[model samples]
Target: MRRDDLYITVPSLFRCPISLDVMKSPVSLCTGVTYDRASIQRWLDSGNNTCPATMQVLQSKEFVPNRTLQRLIQIWSDSVARRQLDAESAAANLSVVPSQEQVKVLVKQLDNNCYSSLEKIVSFAKESEENREFLATMDGFLDTVFDFMRNADSDIKLIEQVVKILDLILSKVSEKKPLLESSCLSTILLVLQRGSLDSQIQSVRLLESIAAVGGESKLKLAEKEGLLTELVKSISKDKDPRLIEASLSCLIAITMPKRVKTKLIQFRTIPELKNLISEPNTSVSTIEKSLKLLETLSSCKEGKAEIWHDSVLLQAVVQKVLKVSSKTTEHAVTILWVVCYLFRDEKAQEAVVSSNGMTKFLLLMQSNCSPAVRQMSADLLKIFRVNSKSCLSSYDTKTTHIMPF
Candidate 1:
């Protein structure tokens, strides 16, 4: 039993203001304030001169050990640890298993469409990991919830709670085959189209989880009417970073099947994804997913044509190589490779050289990129050397092996 498991409240005097944890070795600065030695040292090392608690500049860097606070913290920790151990021992003796009758009553309440019953169900699921596991094992529990969601008269608030609880239960349950085949998928998709922001986010996450376990169901999800369009619209309209990320992730999952790849292109997903990549404030993870999706889209001729037709999109794709993570660089280079090799667009080749993409490619080869990236960069350089002879001579290269055409 750890001190964190206990319900005891630690005294503020015994805790460090910086770390917010009980101090093992208390120290005081010239400002007449006390902190843990390590915490204050870190604060000072980070170039902060003002005391964290007092906000006063320190006259000196010297600190004196506070033996009194150290003793107090140690005593309190021991007392908390003892209490935690006793609590754990008593809990072990208590049986927390829900009887068969209780399970029947909860299921009945869920089917009754009572708001209080739904609230209790959600509370039971969150009370502990044990309750979640127990709920997953109940027969027809998920089906009952899905049926409630599919019914038209189900209250919006109740549906939102049910979707959230289903999200939780699905995360814990290993067998999600039932969800992929259930009518709930269309209901969730409808929620994605019309539900509130919270419900929309949850619906996207639920779809993402299902897509993770790819099968025929992934293909079915991709073919679902209006699903891809809704996902694209979500990305374009939502300002919340979490919602954008969830939407992008869901798009990536559904597009895994080759049949669905063209569906995204038809929905005009390329321009939206390119816009996201070019956004100055977009997060790194979102950029990575966008790049990955673009890589997938480039596999088809329509994808290639859509990307090459836009010079800004082509330049952005080229500039991404060696600009972000190694994986991102690899994906970026893969997009370029498809354009320059598979599609063989003359303007696209020229755009890469104009964007200083040739320089980035050469630098990528010299850098510590993955072997696949190095090979792809080398292959792209070869294409530039052959097709764009005048552009190749602009860069100064010492190696004769990479001479200008």
Candidate 2:
């Protein structure tokens, strides 16, 4: 409709009931009342959008000032802004306000959802050419966003997001060198310690990432923090075996081969941990987890020492599993099988001979028992014969990887 038509047709709607004039500000009403722009805008923003006097319903979307009206409002607003700037300039006796280039930069950052564009922002932060102040601001922005992400629930994706946060943190530590020296490193560790089971598990996986990025000093710092032992212990005690298995796998993956033996030995993990491998009656997850821990522990040179150790830890581990009245016979034999295989390794063979481990092997073979026991005895006997430089081969060589799996 034409302005004139609107004016004529809507005269009553425009007039404020109380003032009863030409409705100077084009007052609106609901249920026989009137309100100004501020009140109406407040109501609209709150999702109410109702006229006060007549209680007339209003859809906030319908109140747009079209091209002509908007242009007029902008002209007035620009004049007001210009006057303020002029006044500020005059007070400081300067031609213009100090550059608010910062506002523009922040606007761009907010406009592009730049926070979610993690890699780009992080790489930009790393660039030497970027203004140092700008980098600082960008870091603050990213930190805000990361803090929000840390609130996501404990689903897999949430954990994955935490991993992303951790990776970015690691990247910062790499580039900044002094970054992890701050409280953020401690905070990151705390989050990993307390995150969901899956997140906790991935926290273990981050070991290798940290190893890759963290130099020797930082690595020792990590060790001082006791994170490795904490990670393994968390998995080792988990009721869900897969988590334990994953933890061990990642631990092994991250550990340097040379350091593995010492670390495991320091933790006293050899035989006490090894007993879980042959757990036949347990959930496959449990059995699998035990095997994985064993696998990782055995990957080092000192693992050979367990088989031939004068400590008899290996015999004790196998015996512990055999002693379990809960379906452990197969597991026991499997333990023996693993010991035999390790014995074939020259280091282990030498250790065994030095330790006189052969005496126990002979004893198990001679023990009178069920045929299954005899069969296992014969298997180990054949293995000893084949590998022993001894005259008689007791294991038939057919049943080596033969666990009850």
Candidate 3:
């Protein structure tokens, strides 16, 4: 397609966001991107590509251009210009060609092809960091990114491409927090809002990301938006084991401090959790997850002692761990370790530091535990004996392991 033809066709194809017309020059801008070529380039030159809307930072390596299509566009423009001059001359002197409209459509198709090529090229440019030539380009690029993320579902192909790009960006830079805080994070949240199960699963992973790259602000915002709770419940409610495990892992990361960690364990005594802990279909990973959460709660100086204050809560946790058969070691080791640490009062100590704790461990050790669980159980017994002189001898050997967990 000739350059003139490209002008006709390209705009119709790319669906330029700014002008709501065909992309002419097609430049990404800061305030709003432009389809005019000169404007897009000027924006790039001015370092406006990183973010048009929010002015966030973006790496230039993100973009990669298609050179073959670039050459085709140049040739297409030359042909169209020559053809146009011929048509205008012929129409002035005689009847127009029967195929004039067809020619226009053909030209438009070429332009669409050219514009598609440029889109890939610019996307590459974003990835390759090739356009990081100036801060102005970065500014425009970021603006462009916000536009795409906000309209991610504009095209199915585009959605797949954008998700791919997001993965790359996340992998490339660990500190793209500002970009994330803008529409990118929101887009991911929207994935949760309307996406299928796979998308929902992917959405929960953003929490792990926020924990890694963001501080208090973004996470708090996400939490307040109910995304955090949504993720937690997704794990608890999902029938798919893989999705359940992912939610569990995300929850474990989120609850690392007293202010956060205590909430999940707070429901330990609740009727809901009591039922969950007793459900036969629960996976080992999920139970282990709860135990790890408890460990985090126990280790938090501010929240550790509160577990014992509510005897029902304490009983719920202990009873849950003791009832486990297949998922026993994980539950036993984690609960033993955490309970021993947080069981505060003399009665609590009698439970945590007591030999009965050792008995629980000893029973679990006799089960089909792996070396790690057995080792941990033995270690817990030794620690209990040393701290509170509680041996595993409180109950008769035959009946001890049989008591209500």
- Give lDDT: candidate 1, residue 142: 72
TM-score each candidate. Answer: 0.68, 0.37, 0.46
- Full-model lDDT for every candidate: 0.77, 0.46, 0.49
Candidate that beats the other on lDDT, 1 or 3, i.e. the better one: 1
User: Predictions ranked by TM-score, top down?
Assistant: 1, 3, 2
Sort all candidates by lDDT, best to worst. 1, 3, 2
- Which lDDT value does model 3 have at 330? 62
Candidate 2 at 113: error in angstroms? 16
Error of 1 at 381 (Å): 1.0
- The global Cα lDDT (0 to 1) of model 3 is 0.49
Of the candidates numbered 1 and 2, which has the greater TM-score value?
1
Model 2 residue 359 lDDT score: 53
| Per-residue lDDT of 357 in model 3 | 59
